[model samples]
Target: MAGLKKKMTIPFARVPVAINEQKYVQEVLESGWLTTASKAAALEKKFARVVQAKYACAVNSGTAALHLGLEALGVKPGDRVFVPSMTFTASAEIIRYLQADPVFLDTEYGTNLITPGILEEAIALHPDVRFLIVVHYGGQAAPMVSDENQAGILEICNKYGIKVLEDAAHAFPARLGERMVGSLGDVTCFSFYANKPLTTGEGGMLTTRNKEIYDRVKKMRLHGIDHDVWDRFTENKPSWEYDVVEAGYKYNMPDVNAAIGLAQLEMAAEFRAERQRAAMFYYEHLGQLQEFMDLPVTRVPFSDHAWHLFPVVLKEKAPLGRNEFIKKMAMAGIGTSVHYKPLHRMTYYKNRYHLDAKSFPRAEKTWQGNVSLPIFPYMTPEELNYICKTIEKLLKY
Candidate 1:
């Protein structure tokens, strides 16, 4: 490998930025209100308008958003939700938080979605599935829960009073037919981590159409207080009088983060377009390799794809195993990772759910062979060259 040219690096993600993001964050810092977290409310409003979510509430993280979505949907203990086995741990962990059980359903062979057929089969076996938690893996829209596929999955859920909670950490502005991802389901959530399409450094938002759910989420987000806050030490506010109606968690976003998000939201279209451009470049250059790896969906062939992850599943006969390939890339200074390792593989869930990898074959396939490549909105051309060179070296033409 000595004569080989030194390869430039490709980062897995390059956070998008707007011209005004820095200025806005500085303004928030100068304002001196660092912690009360009102920017979360403003960001909520911005989120509602941007994604067309009827209501939006900010939280500390994506995991917190999932938990709040669960609580807002009234998912109580003993409830059983159907979740695809191929997803981030938060998708199932939130269910566990409520003392609820999550039944794992494998994803479709060619798609990241949990097809209605699998869901229908699983539902038929366990008539008690109280919640349908569909995960939209890698920023693509979740499979449409239309009545056509499972005959009456939603209708049956309605009859049984089951709820729908979508885990859309990767999906930002993901579209389902005519509606946005946040608008497609009963409750939707999005992350604004550094790697997400929108970045608030570390923040998330929970959204819904139900006003009642919004009301509860709003009050619960900042502790069950009925008033504004204790910081206003000015004249109009009372000296010391507050009402603690019920218990709540301190999962609100700070103004600094919201300022970043507020500015980032305005640049969403540009960010999305850049992401699309990068996806096109990768596809045009690498798509012929379908003989080597399963390429990402060109369009979902039905609706738009947000392209949050450029995940390529290795063919069984590929030159290297997924782990081996990742090792090679990392050593070459190209970062890579499996989107997930089957939540069943985690010690916590494995012990808690008594999950055996052998029981779910498809999930194991993902665990064994799926690898995500760096597809960022801002990957430099030189960096792209190195990423491509590294892959070309590892694969059989």
Candidate 2:
């Protein structure tokens, strides 16, 4: 052990900071108004403008945003909703929150996305399904509108009168064609968790063009209060006269988190560029290893993808299985994660719904090999080299 070299550590994610992060956060602390206030309100306005949506409501988490979005869409008990089995649990669990049943559908193989074709098939099977939650998987925006010759998800949903709620947890600042993901669907929810493209410590935003839906979410996000606490306190009339219009959850984003979000929002484009740079580096170095592993696929330009995660799929011909590959990467001081194990494979969904793994062929197959690599803003060239080289050394056998 005399001259053994120390291994270099590369984390699965590193939160990138903007110039104003601390400055804005300090101002919020000094103001003594930390709960949902002016800061949160300002964030909503700026976020709406950035995503090109008519209205935005900041909430405590992406899951809260999803719940509110679905509630605003009028999802009720006994309603059947279409959701992809490939995404995070929140996409499907929120349906259960409303006492609705989730009819999980399979995603496309390479992209791990619910395509228009998949939607059509699911709709035919469940003719009464009137709601859909489409996830923009791993920063790549799913096509919500039709392109030249192909019908998009929105078009297919429209044909069946299904309401679409976009779960854009990994897709802040992502686009389809010229439009941002938040503005593409009936309602879109974005996350600002510490590791998301934009970090707010813990927060989310719901965006929509519909005034009715916007108004409903706003009122319902905070115990169904007719007026916001900030509005009541700042206005001359009275601070404690607001009425609870209906039962709602306590899911308001604090001013402290909003302060961080405001700063992060200002630097979103720069953060996205750095993440894309890291993604491109992986593609350049790992392109040759496709015979053993499959790189992420996207229909849009690389710049249009937010690159929140750089996930690879190991093939049967790989030198090792997914778990062994991840273990080897960790041993080499590189952190990695499995994007998902698939909802159909989870005990709760599997047992409760009697889900068969065979039903979600694409998701099950993808899950078997899916491993999310280290991709983050400001990843150094040396660090990138180490990661890719480590992967090649492990898989080239």
Query: Which tens-of-lDDT digit does each residue in 156-195 have in candidate 2?
Result: 8898899999999999899888899889977999988889
Residue 134's lDDT within candidate 1 is 79
Candidate 1 worst ten-residue window by lDDT: 226-235
Model 1 regions more than 4 Å off: 1-5, 36-38, 145-156, 228-239, 298-303
lDDT of each: 0.76, 0.91
Show model 2 residue runs off by greater than 4 Å: 1-6
Candidate 1 TM-score, C-alpha based: 0.91
Scored by lDDT, the top model is 2
lDDT of 1 by residue, 1-397 (tens): 3233445666677776687788877877897877645566677887888777898878888888888888888888898888887888889988988898988887765556776567767877889777888778888775564644453334455656768887778888677666788877678888888888888999898989999887777677778665546233433577586677868778788888888888888887777777776777777677767777777664353226677888888888788889888888877878887787777788887888898888677777766678888877777767766776667667764
